[model samples]
Target: MARAQREIGAALLEVTRHADVPSEALRDDGLIEAIPELAALGETPQDPHWHPEGDVLVHSLWAADLAASHALEHDLDADRRQLLVTASLFHDVGKPQTTRRMNGRISSHGHAERGGEVFRAMGRRLALPRPLVDAVAAIVETHMAHLSVRGDPSPRAVRRLQHRLAAAGTSLDDWGIVVRCDGEARGPAARPDASQPWRRVAARLQ
Candidate 1:
């Protein structure tokens, strides 16, 4: 069982590394089939007001493309770029399990943390390096933190986030990129100041 899982992970890593990985390839190459976890995103419902893109899977694909495009624009090193893309693809992996209709709306509270766990487990099963796994998990867990910064925007909150990234073996710059990509994928409802809050935090950290 362990060996089979490792093989599956390796295949996923290869797919993620492909520079031309189309959103359609997610289904075409049987990646979603190999990794059943991905299919869950399709069934997961998201609040239409916030996720005009439709479903978690659609948002994730957009996020991955945006992250890859940003990585290329910024000339991020290959490994760092791969990490960003991979994290983007899996960032909402937990929403399917956590989705609930509450107060006449949908909410996936704690989905970020749950997604982090899913990312970590998949990374481990794929036999990815421990540091890489930690970095991706940190990105997944904190993906929502940037949005929250719009409310707080405190220097202390920024510093705490910086510390959290540091402890997770990733840098603020990398996390910022991922967060920005996530914001870009939010379609019409995306906050115009999406990147500003994190930029403020990063500036204070520096």
Candidate 2:
């Protein structure tokens, strides 16, 4: 097997074997294992406009921390909240396998696609329910949409996402929360204020 697939396969086996935690806890651990790939893609120093470090892992974890914390404050149901936290944590797990060099810096240009594949494989290895695994994979694939939205999001993009949301149902909100958290954890200057967006979305759903 390829090294990346091997690593993910091993990790999934380990998680499944030692999944002694509550279902929720196991979800958290699974997410942690999945996100290092985001760093591999150079989504680290999340504030791409101004970042000092080349460590994608550090950047990814910081975003995860910020994202999870933000998700905890809302008036979400238990499962949905867990979904948010889990998605935020695993949003970039495919990074380590997709590392590359660009413009005198490191980046993982195709990390999202790579990570999605890794996530799908890992989900199968772990025997995750198809619905749950699919949700996680979709979140990984679409995590970068927010960056585009920050610029000039095309109607096509929004419609595409809306279609995805319609199909995924409640879980789609989890991806949205992850996206918001990603923006906030990027950097001091670039972090968008998540409170309002969180409230708007949360209220609309309720």
Candidate 3:
């Protein structure tokens, strides 16, 4: 079990540090061998209407790559890059558990909230650092913030989200990064306005 944990840690490290496109870091078999649940993420289905690209795994890898590019293009420091890449990798880790056919449509309602709980649990089980665990979990939980405020968003709503992120040891900027990548990772028909989350963050939630 300890060896397995190290392998898991090592695989994650490879993706976080070495892979420009994260999935490229692992040899084909290395990922599923080191981390099976992450592999299971590959089997979980998403609605084509929103994810014509494929499963949660495909979206995740794409998002992570986008995040890596963003970090590089914007000159984000190593710590911030790690946080963004790791958060993107784990953003939808809860989908396999929460997904279901609902009213004839594929839905993983409440997945972001559930993803946060499951990520925290997985991080503890892996003996990961408390700060890393919390920050990633917070990002997973709120990655959907822009959608929740779609159409017209209230200042109070924005401030509440801002405070929640701050309390979690991350901030709106980090959350916005995840949000933008997530939106961009989807099929064209399903992608939200990538600028929306940034607009709210730029407002300073005042």
Candidate 4:
């Protein structure tokens, strides 16, 4: 199982590094099939108002694209860039199991926390490095913090989020990139001002 997980991880890494990874590759290369958790994302519904892209899988792909583009534009180191891309791919891995309808709206309450668990489990199953696994899980766990901060641009909230991520072994620099890419992938329903609060958080961190 360990060996199989390593092979799977390697394949996923290659797919993410491609300049133009087709959505088909996700299925063709067995990424979606071999990983049941990822496969389940296809059936996960999201709030259309927040995710015009339709489903969790589509949104995740868009996020991965944004992550890849940003990594190249910023000239990030290879390993760091790969980390961002991988995290983007699994950022919403738990949405399928967590989705629920509330007040005539779709919501994935605690999806981030659930996603962190899934990410950590995959990392351990794949025998990835401890640091890498922990970093990715930390990013998934706090992926929603940026949106919350956007809704309420309070300095106290920003500081608290920063402290939370720092304690979880994620840097503000990496967190900023992930959050910005996530917002950019929200399709037509995305708000231009969504990144502003994160920008302020970045400044505070510096």
Per-residue accuracy of model 3 over 43-132 as CA lDDT, tens digit each: 999998888889998888888888999888888877788889989888998899999998777999888998999888877666666887
Query: Candidates' TM-scores?
Result: 0.89, 0.63, 0.89, 0.85
Misplaced by over 4 Å in model 1 are 1-3, 149-152
lDDT of 2: 0.55
lDDT of 1 by residue, 1-206 (tens): 23377777776666666665536656676777667678889888899999988999888888888777777777777788778888888889989879999999999999999998987877776687788789889988987886674454788777787789889888777787777777778889775535467667667657
Higher lDDT: candidate 1 or 4?
1
lDDT, model 3: 0.78
Off by over 4 Å in 2: 1-54, 148-152, 169-172, 187-189, 193-206
Q: What is the C-alpha lDDT of each candidate?
A: 0.78, 0.55, 0.78, 0.77
Residue 119 lDDT, candidate 2, scale 0-100:
72
Candidates in descending lDDT order:
1, 3, 4, 2
Candidate 4 total steric clashes: 0
What stretches of model 4 exceed 4 Å from their correct place? 1-3, 17-25, 149-156, 193-195, 201-206
lDDT for each residue of candidate 4 in 1-206, tens digit (9 for 90 to 100): 43387888777767666644535567687678777777788889899988988899888888887888788887887777777887888889879878999999999989999999988888877667677778888889888776663254677776776777777667766777777777778878765645466666557756
Better model by lDDT, 2 or 4?
Answer: 4
